[model samples]
Target chain A: MKVRVSVQLKPGILDPQGKAVEQGLHGFGFAVEHVRIGRLIEMDVPGADAAEVKARAQAMCDKLLVNPVMEKASIEVL
Target chain B: MRVAVPVFPGSNCDHDALHACGTVMGWDTIPVWHQEPRLPAGTDLVFIPGGFSYGDYLRCGAIAALAPVMADVKRHADQGGLVLGVCNGFQILCEAQLLPGALLRNASLRFIHADVHLRVERADLPFTSALKAGEVFQVPIAHAEGNFTLEPGDLADLEARGGVAFRYCSPKGEIGEAFVPNGAMNGIAGIVNVRGNVLGMMPHPERVVDPRLGPTGGLGIFRSLAAALARG
Candidate 1:
């Protein structure tokens, strides 16, 4: 199965890179209120079903895929 | 006192640290490879110096934090041995959970490199014993993700316990927004572990030991460590 993990900095944590991108968009005459960046990581996992794949991806997040201190993540099985 | 510096694959500052502790300070220092399962005998301090470990893959220090020798490093800390980490070394400690908090991207969205002033928060621990509380010293910091962050409750708890070892400050010792180089929380430059035996900071103290090179603010750090370990 192919699993996708979308990781993002939690709200209230400043995202300077996102801010820079936002500024760039504004320069192009786009009226964007705010912008935040998230990382998309896709991986292939062996599993019997979607539920099992989700659980396994979540385990990866628990171990090293996501840092509990500063980032949050969402998992999807494809 | 004996010092052990763990050298990771991308650890560029290992030799600099070894030079400061071995050649300059005249202390017995050895570089321990990351594959070694154990530190050399009679190691008084484990100094993890700065560099883009593992090419800063995934995140700074995240990969190196899981290197083979880290179990021994954690054991050394668990046994209450003194440990000091600088720059990327600091990131490794945080990633390894040897220290609290995470170092995020600099708010400026750029790599910052400059000498900055740091205020000593307290001098009671082995790491800062040579300096007085509120003393301001200059040290060079070079990094893109030196912004330190922690959960609100944990941050307050760490503050209340005096876990903050140093803060970005003016030359006259004023800590505030203007002095912050990396946008770290509360202008923190360094922090100590709950046990007070481990310290991790972004600034490179080993770089400024020689007067011919630059500022001598970092002299106190090595002096304090050596003095504290020598007394016992």
Candidate 2:
């Protein structure tokens, strides 16, 4: 099974990169009001059941992929 | 003093650390590889130098924190051994859970490389024994993900435990928004674990240890380590 994990800075944590991107969009005459940058990780997990794979992926996020203190991660079974 | 400096694959400052600790300070320093599963016997201090460990993959220090050698590093720390992490090393310590908080991207989203002033918050710790409280020192800081962040409760606990060792401040020793290079919480530049043996700081003390290099303000850190070892 394949899993996708999206990791983002927790709310109230400053997102400077996202703000820079928002400013760049404004400079280019785009109407992008708010921008928050994040990371998307796709990985192939060895499992037959989707539920099992999702759980394993979530575990991965908790352990290594995401920093629990500063980030929130959501896993999707693909 | 026997110092063990672990060299990760992408570690760039290992030699500098060796020079500062081994040559300048004349300590018995060993450069251990990350692949090694054990630290040398009688290791007094484990120094993690700054660099782009594992190319900053999966977040700074995330991958390097799990290297084979880290098991021994964790063991060493658990036994109340002294560990010092600078810049990238600081990131690794946090990732390894040897220290509190996480270093995030700079508030400006840009890599900052410059000299900043630091205020010694607590001088009683082993790392700051050479400096007095409220003293200011100029040090070089170069990093992108150097802003330290932690949960509120944990932050309070860290403060209550006297874990904060250094704080960013102005050249004249005033701390405020104008002096904070990165948006670190409470302007913290360095901290110690609850055990007070491990220290993690964003500034490169090794870079400023020599007077010819720049300010020798950083010499106190190495001196403190040596003093700690001598006292033991």
Candidate 3:
């Protein structure tokens, strides 16, 4: 199974990288309101059941892939 | 005092830390590899030096926090042993949950490398005992994710417990928005655990211990550690 995890800073936490990206977009003449930078992680897991794979992916996010205090993570099973 | 300085794969300041503790301070210092599951039997202080541990791959200090040595570090900290985490080590301590809060990217979105003034917020703690409260000192800070962030309630709790060890301040010791270098909340530059044994700070004290290299303002921190160990 293939799993994708997206991690993002929680709302209200300052996102300096996102802000810099937004500024760069404005400088390039793009109509951008706001942007929040995040990370995407792809992994391969050996599992036949989709539900079991999703559960394991979620566990990985909770344990190591994401820091709960500052970021939130969502897992997608492909 | 017996000092154990752990060296991770990318730890650059381990030698500086060892030199400060062993050569300069004349303490029995040993370099412990990150793969070791336990520290020396009589380790009194565990110093985690600054660097891009694990190449800062997942996050700053994220992978280093899970190294085998950290399990022993936690056990040592739980037993009231002294642990000092500098810069990237500070980030690892937070990641290990030995310290509160997380170090976020600098608000300026750039790496800050400069000597900044800091105020000794609590001189009575084990880490700052050699200095007096409100005293100003210059220390070098080199990091991209040195901005410390915590929940409002947690911040209140930390302050109420006197965990704040150092705060960014002016040369004259006045703390204000103008003095904050990396946008740390409440100007916090360093903090101690609830027991006051473990300290984590973004500033590099070991880098400033020798006057030949730079200002010796940071020597007081190492002296304080030595004094604390001597009394025990």
Candidate 4:
């Protein structure tokens, strides 16, 4: 199974990279706002089924993929 | 005073830290590998130095915080032993949940490399025992993720508990957003753990601790630690 983990800063946390990108968009005459920057981690996992794969991915997030203090993560198993 | 500095694969300041502790301060300081399950025997202090540990793959200090030697550091901290983290070390302390807040990127989205003034908030703690509250000192800060962040409630609690050890300030001791190098909350430069035995700060005191290297403003930290440990 192919798994993807998307990590983003929590809603209330400040994202300086996001803000800078937003400013760059504005300078380029593009009408964009609330531009947030995040990271994506893709991996291959072997499991009995999709359910098990997702469970395994979520466990990874809980263990190290996500930092509850500043980041939130979503896992997609494909 | 005995200091143990754990050397991660990408650590670049282990020598500086060891030099400051072992040479300048004439203390028993040794470098322990990250893979080591335990720190040097009878470790009195664990000083995590600055560097791009584990290549900062996941987060600044996320990977290094989970190194094998960290478990013993946690145990040592819980037992009221001293721990001081500088720059990348600060990030590790936060990532390890030994400190209260997380260090975010600079507000300008730049890697700041400059000397900034810091105002000592309280002199009663072990980390600042040789200094005086309201005293100002100059130290160099070089890191992109030094802007500290935490939930408002937690920030307030930390402030009320006197956990803030140093706040960025002007040469004359004026503190506010204007003096802050990174957009840290309340212009905080350093903070201590709840028990006051652990300290995490973005500035590189080891770099400027030597008197020959200009102002020895950073010397107070090592001196304070030596005094505090001696008193015990």
lDDT of the candidates, in the order given: 0.92, 0.92, 0.92, 0.92
Q: Model 3 chain B: which ten-residue window has the lowest total lDDT?
A: B208-217
Clash pairs, candidate 3, are none
Measured against the true structure, the TM-scores of the candidates, in listed sequence, are: 0.97, 0.97, 0.97, 0.97
Worst 10 residues of 2 chain B by lDDT: B208-217
lDDT for B60 (candidate 2): 98
**Candidate 4: where are CA atoms >4 Å away?**
none
Q: After superposing candidate 2, which stretches have Cα over 4 Å from the reference?
A: none
Please write out the lDDT profile of model 1 over residues B72-132, one tens digit for every residue: 8899999999999999999999999999999999988889999999999979989899999
Tens digits of lDDT, candidate 3, A1-78: 999999999997899999999999999999997699999999999999999999999889877999877899888888
- The Cα error of candidate 1 at residue B59, in Å, is 1.2
Worst 10 residues of 2 chain A by lDDT: A54-63
- Residue pairs clashing, model 2: none
Judged by DockQ relative to the true structure, which candidate is superior, 1 or 4?
1
Q: Which tens-of-lDDT digit does each residue in A1-78 have in candidate 2? A: 878899998997888889999999999999996699899999888989998899888888878999999899888998
